[model samples]
Each structure stands twice: as C-alpha cells, then as structure tokens.
Target: MTYTVNCSILLTELPLLERPAAAKAAGFDAVEFWWPFESSVPSDSETTAFERAITDAGVQLSGLNFNAGNMPGGDRGLVSWVGREGEFKDNIDVVAGIGERLGCTAFNALYGNRQEEFSPEEQDELAARNLAAAAEGVARIGGTVLLEPVSGAPRYPLLKAQHALDVIARVKAESGAQNIKLLADFYHLAVNGDDVAAVIEKHAKDFGHIQIADNPGRGAPGTGELPLGEWIARSRELGYDGYIGLEYKEPQETAFSWAIREHAAN
Candidate 1:
C-alpha cells in the first residue's frame, strides 16, 4: 500500500513551501503537487526554493503538473487551448527543468476544454503537437507524461478513460511519442460515470500514475462510497506498481489517519 500525499491538495493548512515537510511529518516520504508556482516560467530563486523544500524534507517528488493556466480563474489547461501554444511550449522546458532538479519523472498535462473560438478538431490538432513537445522535453529525464480525465470541469474535454486513451493513441501515432500515458484517477472516473472495474481490468497497466479519492463526496477513503481499498488491491493485482496518490479534500489533521489505519489493517 505505498502512497504519496498530494501536497498541493492535502496540506493546504500550511504554506506551499512548507507542505513537503508537513507531509514528511505525517509519515509520508513522498509527495506530489500541482504546478507550485503561479508563473509557468518561475524565476531562479523561486525554482531553487521549491526544489530545496522537497530535498530538505527528504521526500521524493512523486508527481507534478505542468502549468494549467490560472485554474482558479476558470482556465483548465493550455495543451489544447487556441492561442496559448507558445506558453505551453515555453513551460515544457521549465517543467523538465524542475523534474530534473527533483528527480521527479511523472508530469500531468491537463487537456484544455472545448472552446467556441476554435473547433474541437482544431484544439485536438494543437494538443497533439504540444503533448509531443512535452513528451520529448521530459524524455531527456526518462520521464513519463500523464494525461488525466478529470470531473467537475464541464468544458474540459477529456472526461473518460477511452477519451484520454484515444488522445494517447493519436499522440503516439501522429507525433511518434511513446512516453505519454494515462493518469487513471479513480474518483474522477467514477464521478464521470465510467466503469471503474472495466478500466482496471483492461487498462490498469496502461497507467503511468494512479490517484484515488472516495466518490460521492470526494473525501478521504472512509468518507464516501468508494471501495478504495479493494480498488488499490485490484490495481496491484493487475500489475500497477506505482505509488497511490492521495488526491482528495479533507482537513489536514485527519487526512492521513484514514490511510494510516488502512495500511495497518492491510
């Protein structure tokens, strides 16, 4: 039952730079995060502090996201956006740089939502190119690029396992990229009405990373209706050997107790 706390979402009780240490104090030696900086290309000092925070706390940076562009302001991602292609391209090397610095190898690229400005076909064409560049950039570090199908963002196009898989296939075939893979987030899949068991039984091994949260409420393991323990076990049984990322909403103090107790019982 190996786990990595999603510091970006989990330890919000503390400041950003302090969450890695907080995760360590909570008994997790590994952590993941969304883009930690507001800017895609952060200054040298900002980059140094983030890298040092992870290293100094003695926690592995298990996963990270490329800049998704003002998430709080209703932007989801730039990969498929109409006019932000260069920004997405610019952030590629920066993401690779940070990943290189922290020895982190997994990177998530959110597929931007469908836009009226550009046709869906146009957005997807651009996404293939951007995702290729992303894959190539991180390929230098022996990294895998992750594409997730998330819920709650209605305009965001990638919402099902097959939807993301279709894009992965296109990226590989159209752009000759092999490093791009699926980020199978169970809570999102379930919420989007995907057959979680079918995704696991068929494509569990296709995942580059796995995130979990209880469904119906998007909380920690015991706070909702998901059979999260069985899901993890079944994923393992089907050959997924990566860390199970705790990407959910809950109070910081009580967040890890559920995972700790589950681990002990197992």
Candidate 2:
C-alpha cells in the first residue's frame, strides 16, 4: 500500500519546517501539507528554506492545499470569498512553483464558506471561475486540482462526493480544463452521512486522492469503529492507485499501529 503522512496534522509537536524530516525518519517516504505559510506570496528566502527541508529530508511532497486562509480560525478556503480573489490568484504561482520543484502533482482547493453578503448562486459562480484558474495553473506541472467535501464547517457547502463532483464538472465546462478531480476523504463523507462504500464502489477509479481519519473522533484508525482497512482494500480492488494520505490527529509515536493491525487483517 502507498501511504503518505500528512505532516500538517500529524506532526503538531514539531515546528512546521521540521515536519518533513520527521516524517522521513518515521519511515514515510512521502509527506503532504496544507498551505505552509501565512502570506499568500511568501518571500523567496522562506520558500527556499521550505524546499531545502524537503530535499534534505529525502521525502517526496505528495500533495498540498492552495492557500486556505486561517484553517485553525474557521476559515476553510479563499476561492469563493469575493474580496480575496486577488490573494487566491496570486497564490497560484507559488503553489505551482512548489509543486514543480518537489514533483508533487495533486493539490487540494477547499471551497470557501458561503458568505452572508452573497447569495449561494454568487458564491458558486465565483468558485467555479476561481477553481478553473487554479486548475489551469496546476495543469502546467501535470497536476490535478482536488475538490474535497469537508465536515465540521456549517457554512461550507460541499459535504459529500457528488457536491464536489458537481463543482468539478462546472469548472471543466466553464474553463475547458480537465485537470480537476474529487478528493474522496472517507472520514468526511461518513461523518456527513454519505454511503462511503457506494461512493468508492462507483467512483474510486476517478478519485484524485484519498484521505482517512477514524470516524467519531477523527483520530488514527484503530481508535474508532470505521472499517478503514476494508474500505481501503476495496478502493484498491477498484483501481485507485494513488497514495492514501494519513490525515488524522494523534500522537505520532503510537498513531500507526493501526496500519500494522490492518495489514495483518488483510
């Protein structure tokens, strides 16, 4: 099985720039991250340090998020925010540069929440255009822009696979970009009441990427009742060959026993 540690969530005990090395030392050859900087356009010195961390650590940067503002502050993303479109657009070159430098090809774009000042139609329209722009920029590196259905944000409209797929279709039609795809995160889909099995059974072949955290607590797999091993095995049976991102929150030391348990069961 191919697995990549999501350093942004799992390695909270370490400083951000140190996470890729930590992940490499933990036996993972690949790692992923959310936007690693606060500013949309980080200085060259900052980016240079970041790239150095990954290269020195000998780890592949598997996936990254487009600048999603203040994720810990309840902001999901910037694409649909009417006043921040410039920031989102400007961040694309940085995201593309990172992807190209690291040979990373999958990028997630979390759709911004529904703003009170705008109608749903207004937000959706803005999202499609912005997502198309993101897709086009990433496409230059042979990358795919991912749309993920998130849980725990009431204002976020995408809570299921189809919701994201609809936006993917919209972006393709509007911009003639075919580089967009759904990021099927089982934990979010299950928490939001979607039939996760049916989703994987029907569309696993098309998923841009997959992420997992145990249900109920969003912890590592063994801490919850989710049949994650079976689901992942099934997804493999259905031809999803991409890395399964371990995007759970837990103590890094004991977090991966679940993988060993799942492997024994398989």
Candidate 3:
C-alpha cells in the first residue's frame, strides 16, 4: 500500500482553522497540528472548527505535537510531570481526550529534558517513570505516545540510535505499555550523519511514524540534499506503510505545493 503523506500544519504557517483546507488543497491526504491549545484563535471553538474543516476537506489528522518546553525554553518541560503526579495525569488525560476528539492516533512528545546535572542512571529512571505514567494514560484511551529525539535534549542524553533504542526498550518494559512508539525525525538523523535507512532498518520494530526534511537546512525537498524518493522506496521495500509527515520550512509560499507534488510524484 502507498504510505499516506500527512502534512505538518505547524510547518504550513497557516492558521489552525485554515490548515486542513490548505493541506487538502495542496493534495495531502492528512494534516497534523502541533498543539490545538496553542491555536491563535479561541481554543475550544477553534479546535471544533478545525475538526470540521478537516472533515469537510476530507483530510485526516494523523498526529499532534502535544506541548512544548516551559513555554520559553527547555526540552518539552513536561514539567508538570516532575513532582505532581495528579497534575501530570490530568494533563495527559486532557491531551488524550483532545487527541481522541480530533482523530489523532499518535501524539509526539518530549519528556521535558533533564537540563540539570543528574546521574545518567537517575535521568533514565526519571524518564522511564514519567513515560510509564503517560503511556498508561494513553493506553486507557487506545492512543499511542511517540517519543522524539532532538539535538541538545537531555531526554536523549545518549544521542546515538543504539542508545536511544536501549532507553526506549527499558521505558516500554517498565511502562508495561506497548502502545508507545518512536517518531523518527529524518532531519535529526541527517544532522547526526547516520545512514537514515540503516537506522530505520535497525529500529523498524519500535518506529511508528516518520517526519522528514533535508539536512543542513531543514527545508522542503528539492531545495535540500536529501534523496527523499530513494528513502521512501527503501521504506516501502521494507514493508513499512505509515504516515510520512511533511514538516519543513518552505523558502517561499509557493514552494510547498511544488515540493509536495514533487514528493508525491516519486
């Protein structure tokens, strides 16, 4: 089966309510948002309208970005999960509810980077505990949580793919939640100078979705050095059928449409 291309609305620069329509106009089968609560328009009302627009446009919402660091800086600052268990549970419940209502089956999140000097073991333990808690909540709703690896994030203290996989395995084992998965951001892979297909092959079992953009400059395809068509073909050869989110900053407004068509043609 052909993999569905989900346009990352966050990279589209379009307002939440208008994103779904615009993505459909651009020929994407699905649209993804960062966090609905952060919409420029009224949260509740705009979210509902956003849903309607997607349905009207016949676009599916494949995933959401959950939340960002403490609003200012830090990695995700899933800070709410740090000391207050109740608060963390409530937050996940709310986000999961929103995801369910919006038709998002996967929610990508950063585990609030451990920006301080904590023992490597301690950091992993904290991440494992937090992920376990979050995964349990997600599993209750049949939703999956995707842990993303970003540069300079403590959550990825061990930046290499092998280390990341080990951590992920431990987290899933401890969490007792098999619904959790990995979000393979190809941009990061390129930055690390790793062979994207090799890494994907190594972690295909844990990987659920992929976000792609060219290296050096995280720009749309054709404007960068990545051979996206070859990568897509490799993925297909491996029997991987999943959404490939188009998340990148376009050099020009007209560039995105051209890029998407180019990518689709491949």
TM-score of each: 0.98, 0.97, 0.82
Q: Per-residue lDDT tens digits of candidate 3, residues 1-266? A: 23333444343465557667767675667877665554212356755675687689788878875555343345454522345444445567666766677667787766555545556566567767766777776676678877766654545454455555666688777756787777777777677766777976766545777777776577666668887767766765676577877777663365466555767887
Better of 2 and 3 by TM-score: 2
- Candidates 1 and 3, the one with greater lDDT: 1
Q: What TM-score number comes out for model 3?
A: 0.82
Candidate that scores best on TM-score: 1
Ranking by TM-score: 1, 2, 3
Candidate 3 Cα misplacement greater than 4 A, ranges? 1-13, 38-50, 70-74, 77-87, 117-120, 152-158, 257-266
- Report the lDDT of model 3 for residue 141: 64
User: In model 2, which regions exceed 4 Å deviation?
Assistant: 260-266
RMSD of each: 0.9, 1.2, 3.6
Which residues of candidate 1, in runs, are more than 4 Å off? Answer: none
Reference-based lDDT, residue 185, model 2 = 94
Write out the backbone clash pairs for model 2: none
